[model samples]
Target chain A: MPFWLDAVRRFERAIGVPVERFVTSDAYFDLLPHLKRAQSQLEDAVAAMTEEWYRLVNLPSGSDVRQMREQLSRMERQIERLTKQLADRDATGPTPTVRKRDQNG
Target chain B: MWPLLGSDLAGRVGRDLERSLWRARNGLRYVQAMSRPREGATPKDVVWKRDRAELWRYRSETPIRYAPPVVIVHSLVSRSYILDLRPGSSHVEYLLAQGFDVFMLDWGIPDERDADNSFETYVDEYMPLAVDAALAVSGAHEVTLSGYCLGGVFGILYAASYSEPPVRNLVLLATPIDFSQMGPMVAAVASGRLDTAELLDETGNVPPDALYTGFYMQAPTKEIAQYATLLENLWNDEFVDAYQAMAQWSRDHVPLPGAATRQIVDDLIRRNVLASGRWELGGREIDFGDVQANVLNAVAVKDNVVPLAVTEPVMQLVGEPSKRDELRLTGGHVTFGAGSHAFKHTLPALSRWLADHSDELDSPKER
Candidate 1:
């Protein structure tokens, strides 16, 4: 599986939804990557979603396959870059968040 | 003394002594809220309301009862009741009416064991358990998850670190991603005047009273002088009731576990790791990109604890579609969940957004 798909599947489970329909739909697969702006993306997605994506992810404002793909793609890359680094072996242990308290009664 | 022992004189002395004894009776355990009580959770100004844990399960009300639920995970410092204060003021109640099966985690004040608790415990234990408990209660196949302030960070961590998190639309309110920019308090913790290690050692959990005092001192006038003014200006029953309720809530501090407090300081505040997306909790590495749900980022314009400066960094990390709408509320931190205004401003926007994007989420892995 593609790194994006592998990562997307994990988040899909985390988010709890199907993806094949989302990625395969005609309206989304051909979505342009350049028009990543939220507003235009929403307008275009709403226009296309009336047919293709009204179900997979029920976003309030209409967002197209192009924008959703862009967003998810960005997220996928981020997760991959971040998690891959942490997965390295020289890692000691995860640091813990601390709060100090004065012992005096 | 013997000469003045007449009944009348002695009785007078006895009365004086009794008055002195009576005055001394007020012991200082949990510092009592001095002013009269007031209503704690009335919606002064709100918009929409409702909640649920996962996607598809937390939906808007009416023609939408079948709407999926949205679970709201609240911060540890404040009470969840803030989300559901008065009828006109309740966030959870509004969501219920909106058709979302609302599940909320009220991390009731931490005791001694809670002190031993670490951030890992919250991410691994409390949050997951809360998610599981909510699922069992609602019996929903999926749920939507949202959080405010500390809870927001927890939501992100839980979603990112775990291969399977029970959430759909991920919402964050007044949550900070970059601790390096957190105002004076963060500076203090970063420095050691607010010695987290020492404080934790004294008691397993840092006392709520001390934390409240620190926060109060951050804005002493707001905590003290303002209340005195409000008392003078508002004389109505509702005013008094509201004052008392808020007063009680403010004073009702929950002890933070020593370990958890330590980790927060060392990992986030001190190391400034969460922003770098290098934070870890509960034996899992937190990767913000791991969160790919439809996100609704609501920020407060004048948030002191989680300032907008830090918030922007958090949103940018989402990697999700930045919506045609990012809501910046026009009030303090608490207004997002309290008052009638929240319905109009906060909940409606939230529920409407969640409803529109509920299905992009998945369910828990079957055991």
Candidate 2:
């Protein structure tokens, strides 16, 4: 390692302690919720605009596509369950039946 | 004294010049992306597949000496390559050498199809079938279930849910049991300040970048520090390769399914179900005391991803006191599977505990 790089590392270490402390502090966490709320509000605004644009264009919105995909995923899950049941049945084979008394008896 | 000092200075200058040249050469290669390090290069055959999940049986020339095979369950939000990171530093490779028949359950990259995959889907549906497949392939009645991170939560659910779980031994690596201590991002969701629904994109999943951002926020300056270190060590090929592989893995995250995220936030984080011992999955109450498998909960001392406080409670909740053990390992979260610390300390300790619990085969079975 170079001498200059070592000095840079030393500087980094000096500042890093306080930076890390602040990042993990209660104040940072308290500030995060507000930031998250603002982000969510912005996302909602964009989504509403996108939906309106899709309505004007006579095209399905992203939300619509998501719903359809979710429905398809549900059907896929059902099919998977059915397939698993069939496989389980095949593995177990048919249940044995009780034999009746002979006709001669 | 002056002559000696002059000679020493000259020697230092000469060495520094040589290193600078090597650094320049290596930096050029790095920028061009030349001689990229290969990762997850260990040979493995997919023994079973369902949806995006695949159970991989690692190929080994050595004979299997253990009765019950080891089945690794990886976390959903990351690639499974971390376990088999590189040939020399792979946990899978280490286990193979230790004479355990190893199988890894990799939840492949998820998109729209897996948006509805919840805890029940993993714990109830996929895990049981994956375990059965591993058992059938290895001709073993039971298996040693090793789960990493979120996967370990699934292992806990699976073992506790079943009356007779086929797991003979359970190993949890850096698995979060108390989500309240999982840092600010999770705390936001837990406190209901940040809704999980807002995190989901149109694909009905939390995007990879979102997950990456969450992790990145934990140590915002770490990336800058790492790059500085990387630049300094650019002359060393071994260091360069290791750095590249680890850096790639750190940035690489997969989308988390929306339904699973919701459940995780509500049940695990908000309610703190795992810690409280009051979790219900698929109408069945999950009780950790019901887990009959001998448990080994390994918590990394310096894991920012899943802090020690987040994982330490598992030692109290799981199985009988006599049947459970905790390993407090040194280093960060990835140390259990990758890097020098794993090869030196983590693997040996894990293998020793696993071997002690495992039954030896009368004769070794060839691959």
How does model 2 fare in lDDT? 0.84
Q: Over the stretch B7-48, how does candidate 1's per-residue lDDT look in tens digits? A: 779898897676445433321111353543333342222111
Q: Give DockQ for candidates 1 onward, in order.
A: 0.01, 0.15
Per-model C-alpha RMSD? 26.2, 6.3
Instruction: Identify the runs in model 1 with alpha carbons over 4 angstroms from their true place.
Output: A1-105, B1-66, B223-225, B322-325, B359-367
* Total residue pair clashes for candidate 1: 92
lDDT of 2 by residue, B68-180 (tens): 89999999888888998777879999999989999999998887778888998888778887888887788888889999999998888887777667888999999998988
| Candidate-wise lDDT, in order | 0.59, 0.84
- Candidate 2 lDDT score at position B102: 95
What lDDT score goes with residue B97 in model 2?
93
Best candidate according to lDDT: 2
All candidates: interface RMSD: 27.5, 12.0
Q: How big an interface RMSD has model 2?
A: 12.0
